[model samples]
Target: MEFTQLLERRRQRWTRFALLFTLFLVFISGLYLVVGEVFISPLEELSALEEQLILQLRLPRLLAALAVGASLAVSGAVLQVLLGNVLAEPGVLGISGGASVLMVLVLFFAPALATPFGFMLAAVIGALAFTILLVFIAKSMCLTTTRLLLVGVALGILSGAVVTWAFYFSDDLSLRQLMYWLMGSIGAASWYHHLLSLILLPVLIWLCCKGSLLDKLMMGEQHAKQLGVDVDQARWQLICAVSILVGGAVALGGVIGFVGLVVPHLLRLALGSENRYLLPISALAGAILVVLADLIARTALDSAELPLGVVTTSIGAPIFIWMLVSHHDSR
Candidate 1:
């Protein structure tokens, strides 16, 4: 019963952490709104100009940060289970690459489809297509571990090649725009873009609720089958859900890397890979991370904002390297 007590205490601690994290998310979100170029106090009555800035600019950007963060984190958590790799994330696995390629093509060649709704739609299609291809290739070849990661890396490289070619032929104006986006920023976010992204909320909820299914999948296919799970059907469903999440995030935030890779991995380490805890916590932590990153991106320099990706990469890369080293040492 000592073991049981230990488990119970651990659960209690995590429950407290989750509650604190939720409040932290709210606090940071409020902080994000008021702490920009013109600091607005929460207690003070808003001026018309302050109202416009908060509602039109800060609010929407905050929403985008929340959505992108939660989506990528949850997707990473699920992909880690599905691929059986701590390293699986939207960017690393080329899911974001797929969405990026389509977005670039559309913005360059079919500029008419560059609207908020159109870009979202294109990104979903691209992500879904690439996810389907990934699943098919993995299944046909029975890819596991290193082979699967190599395949994902290869896919990412191919997408990069296509995007590079597009960049080569683009005009200077278009090239500049694409470069900024590829580096990732929510500085241009507006209500319309956030609204388009919100449509993915239901899908995100559905994914978070799949914790039990992921728990089963984590045990391997034959074992999951023994437990009456339709492993193939479930795999496809999870893949599709991840595609939508990754696509929506890429559409809204442009290829913000490492939120996915880092958040869930950290949570799994702390929370012991019990996905019901891991997934939801991952979402909250991811949202907090991105919002904070966005805040730093905009406020770090008086004259100019940094790219969102640059901030996250700077933060995530060292942790990622640490993870690599720790994993190797453990092995």
Candidate 2:
């Protein structure tokens, strides 16, 4: 790359970063205002309680939401590139289902192991296992995009069946806990969850960004091999990165879906499909969406808080429908 080209790339990246930063600030302000109304005790006491709520309660949830959303979104972007399919995501690829299945198992047989680290570990293992399974199938079958999606759908159904069985066999308390987690919420967000996710997300993002060899692989494995890109190694590394990002988010927030799928696709549509730009931009957009969704989940009703998954799906489904229709019309 020439110096001028590099300068132009840097300028473009900074521009995207600035836009993302502005959106992030707007999201935080909106979340603060919405949460201020819910948690502050009285109108006169608003200022003091707003700070308290932001620091003690809402801030942790917001940070958690940001981490989960960013991780999922970036992971999805990488998956899209790696699989050469716009629809590939942790949720669609059965990674989230894998994590959910593991968590459900823990809730059933080992309720005492329901700590954050335990859940996160289980989620990572489950995600990696399923990812390996998918890779094996892909390689063995010379998988096309459609075939990969079909395989993922099959894995998702299998994981869901396992989860259902666990729920059926569990005690009422365990079942209730599993159900709530599956529905997904930022309600349980705490400093511990925030710190755990914070540690993993940044490192994973760094790894993904550094994997600019991804651009070579995106041209197709045969071409990547010809260009000395170590195709299988790159694929493995990408899978591990995606596993960590998706597994960590699911463990922390309990299977919040669609942000991963929607954010990156939208970013690609707006900014083109380069992973370097797509990764960070989609991360920021995902964080903004999730924080806003959290605000809605908390305050959209009179007394009861709604599940975060419900809010995301409500928003995501329409956007998905629009994308499908638009694609069809374009074709």
Candidate 3:
């Protein structure tokens, strides 16, 4: 009987994995169809144009979508574990807002500093600064999730206000650049972006996997301390890991939201709350969501592509609301 039960459990796990993998494959195939003109009757005759579209447009956008999705998902998973809150994400924690504010400032004051590397540096610095502030607030306020969230929300509002004021006073040329960047696009992606994301993503993944030790810490600080976990050290390391991942993502994709929050929660529901599975699963799920969303963003309208951020928000918000309602009904 025990052996039979074990077999059933393993089968169930594999079934879920297979489902997620199948979804990913379908998303990829759909993206190819939409972006490659494979389904468009008139465009099917134009082989050269199809090749150009696939090579010049679809591939880079897909890569950017993958990077942004994985980063946000991992970052969200880390934050949720660290704070013991289901809703915690990089954006909610003011990390993304902080990065945005700094990038806007750079654009306003020194337009020449708007390169990818420069924007990445500014984003990292901003995320790190806000993370430090959050730590201080959490420690001083007894480290409750509610307090942490409230503080983060306040900081996010402040950062947004700063960005708004800067935009109000900025010149038209820089403002146009800033506006486009804020809208978020994979249209500007290049081999350089792909290479940089490839380098940084693995490092962040490794660090986040290491920091998955925090899932144990989340059981309760007292229990974690008894288990020999260095609570404070683990917290700091996790914060740094999330900062790098979220900052790099925002710098690359410009404030795409909700993938992190939604993907991790969905994975947690499927795979349980063990960060070991949760982190990697969320990463894959996130990559799939972004890639599919980008595909729709490019093709859902006419010749004009929609902003990737707008696409994510439109899709994610409804799903998020449904999740909330379902959870409430279950309770």
What is the Å distance of residue 307 in model 1 from its true position? 0.7
Q: Is candidate 1 or candidate 2 better by TM-score?
A: 1
lDDT of 1 at 28: 97
Best prediction by TM-score: 1
Clashing pairs in 1: none
**lDDT per residue as tens, model 1, 1-331:** 9999998998887898899999999999999999988999999999999999999999999999999999999998998887777887888778889998998888878988888878888888888888788767776888765677778889888988998888887778857776787788888888878766668899889898889889999998999999999998998899888888988898889888889999999887776888877888889999999999999999999999999989998999898778867866765
Give the per-residue lDDT digits (tens) of candidate 3, residues 192-300.
7776596567856785476448667778888889888998898887788777777788788887777888888887776677676667767777888888777777778
TM-score preference between candidates 2 and 3, better one: 2
* Superposed Cα deviation of residue 49, candidate 1 (Å): 1.0
Q: By TM-score, rank the candidates, best first.
A: 1, 2, 3
Flag regions of model 1 displaced more than 4 Å.
1-7, 137-144, 172-175
lDDT of each: 0.87, 0.77, 0.75
**Tens digit per residue, CA lDDT, model 2, 221-248:** 8888889887777788778877877788
Clashes of each: 0, 0, 0
Q: What is the C-alpha RMSD, rounded to one decimal, of candidate 2?
A: 3.3
lDDT of 1 at 21: 95
Model 1 error, position 50 (Å): 1.0
TM-score of each: 0.94, 0.87, 0.84
